[model samples]
Target: MVTYIARRIGAGLAILFVIAALGFVMLSINTDAVVRGILGPQASEEQAAALKADLGLDQSLPVQFIQWLGGVFRGDLGRSWFTNQDVNELIGLRLPISLSIVIVVLLVTLVVAVLLGLGSAYFGGWFDRATQILCILGFAIPGFLLALILVTVFGVYLGWAPVVGFTPITDSLPGWMRSVTLPTIALASHSVGAVAQQVRNAAFGVLNMDYVRTLRSRGIPEWRLVLVNVLRNSTVSGITVLGLQAVGLLGAVVLVDKIFAIPGIGEMTINYTVRGDRPAIMGLILVLTVLVIVINLLVDVFVSVLNPKVRTR
Candidate 1:
């Protein structure tokens, strides 16, 4: 198990290095363009040269990359070209909002999907048909559109939750919950369907196994059989789907953030991209890449725990 974990961590680090190098190279390709975008076309050549030098863009690509990598190791993500604010500070302020929404969304998706999936598979009747229909609709509608509808209904008409702005959890837990509720539902809507389908399929297969029949014949309680035995075996697929969905949620949060006026990494990303801020953009990319790696590693560990064979493999 230790070896397996070490291998996964090593691979994750390799992926992070590759992604960072590629992102830096691509973003660094148009140094002149970035300078012009920041300083305006009316800026003189000397001004551009000065700006480039200040940003360390005058150095060779290899040298600049090495410097940037060293800074990253030392916990410095550099500063935004446009705002001159430290990239680390900017991301730190916004990352919590996005993470809060994502964490809540995952928890909700797990509980709801498990219930829906196991219930549909075990019952195999009207409930199953309803779950199938729900999954189809969930897939059909996009998360952003759902977010808009939620804002309109829950925020505008119902006035049940605030549609715009976020309150830090440090300030008030209830305020934070209210701030994140709609966004969480909007982001989780699609994931719930995907995970539920995976769980349902896995559970259905598990129920047909010989041991399950033996348990049933021995008059083991149906609830216990489904919840304890069937759910346990089916979890591997459900967990895999949920992990993939978590990564996707980061992207979807961009659109949701816009609709809801929540300041998060997604909002910062769009702002930096529009201005062609390479330092901030690269920093965001690196942070996001690390997040994906960490999430996948956790998923791998969870899968190995649930199925010991996976660790051996």
Candidate 2:
């Protein structure tokens, strides 16, 4: 198990390195444009050269990458070209807000999806039909449109939750919940359907497995039989879907964050990209890439735990 986990972590690190390299290359695509962004489009060539030199853009690509990587190792994300503030500080302030929304959305997706899937599988008939309809709608509708609709009904019409802006949880828990509830629903709506379908399919298969049938014949309590034999076996696929949805949620939240007027990493990223703040953009990309890699690694480890044969492989 230790070896398996270590191998997974090593692979995740390698993935993160590749992501960093790709992000750096992409950020460097318009070198002169980046310099112009720093010095303004109207600046003379001399001024651009001066600014570039000052910002170390005059350095070779390999050296620049090494410097950036070293800074990252030391927790220094460099200065933002737009604001001249430390990129790490800027991200630190906003990361929590985004993380909170993402975490809540994940929890909501997992809990609701598992229940819906299990119920749809166990009950069948009308319950399954209704769930199928929901899954179709959830899968078909775009996330942004759903976010807007939710904002209109829940925020404008019902006035149950705030439509725009976010309240930090530290300042007021109730206010935070009220502020975030609609965005959470919007972000999680599709994921719930997607994951629930996976769960339903997996559960259906597990329920009909020979081991489950034998367990049922032995007259074990129905709840235990389902929980131990069915649910446990079904969870591998459910977890795979869940992890994928979680990664998707991270990306989707950028749009959701904008619609809801939240000041988060996504919104920050958009602002930085618009201003051509390469350091900030690179930092954000690397952080998000690491997050994706880490989540996948954890999912792999958890899947292996659920099925020990995976460890041998």
| Tens digits of per-residue lDDT for model 2, 237-280 | 88988899889988898898899989998899788888778899
Alpha-carbon TM-score of each model against the true structure: 0.97, 0.96
Winning model by lDDT: 1
> Where does candidate 2 stray beyond 4 Å?
none
Whole-model Cα lDDT of every candidate shown, in order: 0.93, 0.88
lDDT per residue for candidate 1 within 119-232, as digits (tens), equals: 999999999999999999899999988888999999999999998999999999999999999999888889999999999999999999999999999999998998899999
Lowest lDDT block of 10, candidate 2: 226-235
N/CA/C clash count, model 2: 0
Task: Give the C-alpha miss distance for residue 254 in model 2, angstroms.
Answer: 0.8
